[model samples]
Target: MSLDIKRPNSNKTKKKMGFIVKMQLHNNNNRGGSNKRNLFFVFFRSYYRWILWFFLSLYFFTSYFAGDQSSPSSTTTTRLLSNHNPSSSLPSRALIESSAIVTPGIFSGMKIYIYDLPARFNVDWVTKSDRCATHLFAAEVAIHRALLSDSSVRTLDPEEADFFFVPVYVSCNFSTSNGFPSLSHARSLLGSAVDFLSDQYPFWNRTQGSDHVFVASHDFGACFHAMEDMAIEEGIPEFMKKSIILQTFGVNYKHPCQEAEHVVIPPYIPPESVQRAMDRAPANGRRDIWAFFRGKMEVNPKNISGRFYSKGVRTAILKKYGGRRRFYLNRHRFAGYRSEIVRSVFCLCPLGWAPWSPRLVESAVLGCVPVVIADGIKLPFSETVRWPEISLTVAEKDVKNLRKILEHVAVTNLSVIQRNLREPAFKRALLYNVPMKEGDATWHILEALWRKLDRSYRRSRVLSE
Candidate 1:
C-alpha cells in the first residue's frame, strides 16, 4: 500500500478554503442590489488574517532590536543579582548587600586569582614536615589549599580576578632547637615570591600589591617575630606593606605589628582532629573539670629585656590560684590535650606571646566555655560568630577575681552560654576544611574579602565599562 503526505504549507489551503466560503456567502446573500456593502464584507473577511500576521511580526521585530540596544553593564548587573542561590540564608544576603560597593551580589560574584608559584614556596615545606599543615600556625597552608579547590570563587584567568592570592608558606620553616617554626627566613621567602610574581605577571605591579592577599599566621603577623619588642623593631616588610594579610594577631589598641590592611583569622586546627575529640567525648556531654589550663604558668616570670611572657598575665594567674581546687592549671604539654578540653567547663585562654591563642579555637570548638583573659584582644569572625554570648572576657589585672567572675556567670548565664557554644555554626567557623564547607574559616575569610570589594580595581573598571 502507498501513503501520501500533506504539503508543508497546509495552513495556506485552509485560508483559501475560508475565503472561498465567504465569497459564496457574499454572492448568494445579495437579494437586493446593495453591491458596495456585500463587497466590503467579502474584503474584510478574506484579508483579516494577513493584517493580524503583519502586526505580530512587526511587534516581535521591534522587541528583538530594542533588546540588542540595551546597555551591557545593566544586563551584567541583573545577571549578578540573579546569581545568588535561593537556598542561601537571609543573613548571608544582608551581609553581602549591605555594602554599597561596586555592585549587588558581588559576594557571590567574587573571583580570586591564585598564583601558580614554584613548589618550593608552598608544598615543599609540607612534604618536609607533616606538622607544616596541622600545626597551630598552619592557616597559611589551609587557606591556600582550600582556595585551590574552590571553583566558585577561584578563577584561572588573572585579568578577571578581583584579588591575587600569593601562596607563600612562611610559617612552615620549623626549627630543630625548640620544635617551633622559625621566622628567620619568612621575610626573605615572601620577598622572593613578590619579586617572582612582579617579574612574570603584571598584576603585582598594576596595583603595587594593593589588591593582593597573603597569610602571616604567626605571633606578630607580617613582622614574623615571636617576641613583641623584636617584632616592633622590625616592622612589616616594605614589599608587603600595601597588601592584605590574613593573620592570627590582632588588638583593639594601635600596634606596630598589625599596621597593614589585614583580616583577623583563627589559627588553623585540623577538622578531623576536632571531630575525633568530639567522637571520644561522652555521649551525654558531661563536663567534669571546673577551670582548666595546660600551658606555661611560671611561678616567677623573669623580666627579659623589659618584657615578660604573656605580659606576666599567666604568671599572675599561677601566683593567685595555683593550689585552688577549682583551678586545674598545668605547665606541660599533653599529647591528648583535646580530650581534656572536651571535659572542661572553663578553658583559660590567657595571652601567650600574642593576645590570640590556639586554645581559644580549641575550647570553643570542643563545647568548652573560653575564659578569654587577654586584654584588648580581637577575636576572629566576630561578624558571623557571636563571641560575647559564647565566651567570657576578663581583664588581665583581675586575675585574683577570676573565680568570682566565673561563679557569677555559672549562677546566672552559664547555661545560656553553653547553649550558644553548642551551635555547629560556631564550631564550623573556627575550623578549616580541605575542600571547604559553608560557614567554615576559609568561607568566612572570603566573606571578609567580599566586603572589601571596593578595593577591586577590576570591579571598578567593569562597572564603568
Candidate 2:
C-alpha cells in the first residue's frame, strides 16, 4: 500500500494528486503524460521525509495497541526477570506492590482475641507493686502484656478469633508476711473472670471455654495451691478444666495440676535484668565458682503437711556438700545473686516447693550449666531448646553422686555445654518481650496454641463453612 501526504507550500501539491489519479505511470513512456510521471517522481524524491514520518507513526501506533493487549504477561515477565537479576537498575511495579503488602507470618491466620476484662483482672495489681511484673511468678503478667502489644497474632474482632485470651494477673497478690504472691484469692478471681466472660460474650459459652487460653504461672497451676497434696485434692478449677493454661508448673509424670491442656512456660525474669547481667559479665568468660548454689540450702527441710520442702533434696545437698571445697552454697538471700550465677560453672537447680524453679531460666540465661535435680520436671520450650545438650539432670536419689557427676562432665563436655548455653536463641526463647519477638516465651506460647488449633471452635466452624 502507498500513502501520499500533500504539501501546502507549493504547486507540487497538485502534482502529488496526479500520481494517485493516473494508474499506468510505470508504462507511460508512449503517452503524452510522461512529463507528469517524471515530474511526480522528482517531487517524490525531493520530499522523502514525509514517507519516513508516516512509517514511524504507524509503528508506534501498532506497538501501543499490542502492548495494551499483553500488559499482564509483560508485567509478570518483568517481575520474574528483575528477581533473577540483582543488579536491575529499575525495580518492577509488581515488586513494589508486593513489598508493600503485609504477608501472613508462621501462625498461618491464627488470631487470638484477648478479653477486655476490668483492671481488677490484670493491671490493678501492677499499679500497686512493680514487683508484680518482674517476679518469678509473673509469667501470667508477662505473657498478657506481650500478647496485648503483638499485632501479628492478636486480633480485636471476637467473631473471627481462633482463641480467646483471659489476662488475669493471678500471681500478683503479694502476701504481706513473706512478700511472695499469695494464692488465697487466685481461684476466686479466676472463677469470677470466667463468670464475667460467660455472662458478657458468646465465645466462652460456645465452646465451654475450651478454645480460651489462660496463664496460670504458679506452683501448682490451675489448682491454685503451693502444696502438692492440697493442689492434688483441689485439682484444676471446675470452670477452667477445658481451657488451656500456660503455666510454670509442669511434671513429666501424670499430675492433677497439669491435667488441663497446658503449655509449660518459663517463669518471668525481666529481660532488662538479663541484659544487665550480660553487660556486667566477665570479658574472658571466666567462672570462678565451681559447682555454685546460692539459695535456701536448708540444714533441715521443714515438713509441711507430710511433704518436705524440695522433697528433702535441698537439705540433702546442704548436709552433704555444704562445707565441701569449691561448693559455694548460701543459706541466706543476696541481692546480687545473679552476679554469683554469672561467675559460676555449675549452678544448682534443685527442686523448690515445686519441681520447676526460676533457676532453670536464670542459670541458662546467665550462661551457667544448670545441674537440675528435679526429676520428672518438664522444662519450658523443650521443643525449641535441647535441654539435655545444655544442662545436666540429676535424680533426687543421685544427690550423693552430684560431685562425681559434675567432675566427670567437666572432664568431658563442660565446654560443649557452656558453648550451647552461650547461644542467644536459648536465652531469647525463655524471656518474654513486649510486642512478641519471634521464638520468645510469648511466641512459643502462640506456637503451642497453633498446635492445638484442632480445639478452636472458630477454626473448626470456618473449615466446615
Candidate 3:
C-alpha cells in the first residue's frame, strides 16, 4: 500500500496542478470581462427612459421653434406675399427684373382710368400741406404725380377702365386764420365731388364708386364726408367709402382710411433723399450720433388720448428724454438735419401732426435706421415691404425707456438693419419708384386695389342685400 502511494511522479503532479491553476485564472478573467459588460448594460437600461425623454423633448422644442418661423415673423426681412389671387403670381422676381411698374397681367388686363378731377381738387392742397415743418400730408399730390408717369396699365379711355383714380386734395382745405384744418371745408370738397361724379357718370351709380381710389395722408382728410348727415349708413359718403382709399396710416379703427377699401401708401419720398440714398454706399460708413430727432416738440396736452395724437407722443418724448447724451432734439427743424442724419446711426421719426412722414424716407437715405414712434402707422408698401427689418419701432409707452432700449441693440445688428434698407425691393416698394420701375409704390397700390376690389364688391353686395 505504501509503494503504491509513492508511485505518482512529483513533476507530473506539479504540471497537473499548474494546468488547473491556469484554467481557473483564465475562467476568472473571462468572467471578469463579462461582468464589466453586464455592468455597462445595467447602467444603460436604468437610464433608457431618461435618454428617450431627453431626445423627445429636444425634438418637440425644435419643432415648436421651427413652427414659430414657418413664415417670416413680424420682425424679419422676409416679405409675406400671400397669393390672394390663387390663379396668378404676384409682381415678384421676374416682374421686378423687368422693372414693370404696372404690368398688364396681374392688373388682369384691367385699365386704371384717372378721373379728370378739376385742378382745384388736386392742386389747391399742395401749398397747404407744406405750410408747417412737422405737419405734412401730401399723398393727394404724390399719387397724382405717380399717375403722371408712363404706365402700360393706364387706359386712355375711361370706358375700358376697371378702376378710377380720383385725384382729390381733400386734406388741403384748412384755415390758416386759426391754424386749424376745417373738417367743414373737407366735407364741402367731398360733397361737391360726389355730386359731380354721380351726375356725370353712370359708373359711380353702378358700384357706388367701388372701383375708385384716392390717396390722402392726412388723418382728417378721409373722415370729411357728409355721409353722417345723409340718410345713409357708414358715416361717410356711400360712393367714397365704397371706393378704394389710399392713406398713409394702414389699418385704423376709425377715420383716415378704414378696412379693405383702404390701401396703406408711403408718404412721398423727397427727390433729395432718394438721390442721396442712391448715391451713398450701403454698408459701413461714418455714423456719428446714436439717435437724431429734430422737429416740433410742442404737443397740445389736452388731446393726449387720441391714437393719432402726434402731440402726446412728442410731449412724452420731449418730456422724458430730450437733450440727453447721444440723443439729439431740436424744437425747430434743424437746418442741418440731413447732414446730422447722414452722420448718425438712428433717426427718430416720431409722429408729427400725423402718423406717416417724409422724415422716414430721409432717415433711410442718410443711411440712418428710422426709429418709428408713431403707433399704428404702417410703413409704405407694407404688403411687400418688411418694415421692422429696416427700422426700430418704439411704442408710445416705451418713449420713457428709449435710451435703455436702444442701448441694448448690438452694433453688429444695426449694421445689417441699415444695409437692408438699401435693398432694391425695399427701395422700389417703399419709395415712389422712378419712371417705369417695377414694384413701384403706385404699382403695388394698383395690385392691392385689384385684389381687394372683388372681395369688397362682394361685401358691399351682401351689405346692401
Colliding pairs, model 3: 99-438, 288-343
- Model 1 clash pairs? none
Shift in Å, residue 26, candidate 1: 52
Question: Model 3: runs farther than 4 Å from truth?
Answer: 1-105, 123-135, 177-183, 224-235, 252-260, 276-284, 299-311, 433-436, 453-465
Clash count per candidate: 0, 0, 2
Candidate 1 lDDT, 30-97, residue by residue in tens: 65556556666767787999989999999999978865653543343332223233345443353345
Ranking by TM-score: 1, 2, 3
Clashes of 1: 0
How do the residues 1-465 of candidate 3 rate in per-residue lDDT, one tens digit apiece? 355456657699668756765665667577876555555565566679999999999999997886454322222222323212223566445223332222335564556777786766766566546642123455466566666675776777777766777777765566769664455566567678877888887767777777777665654336543222221233445456766778665434454235436777776655555565445533556676878888777754444334334657878887777767887787785554676777777788887655666778778755688888877766666655566677899887788888877877644476678667666556666656445345656667766776664634444555789
lDDT scores of the candidates, listed in order = 0.85, 0.83, 0.63
TM-score computed on alpha carbons, candidate 2: 0.77
Candidate 3: count of backbone clashes, pairs at least 3 residues apart or interchain: 2
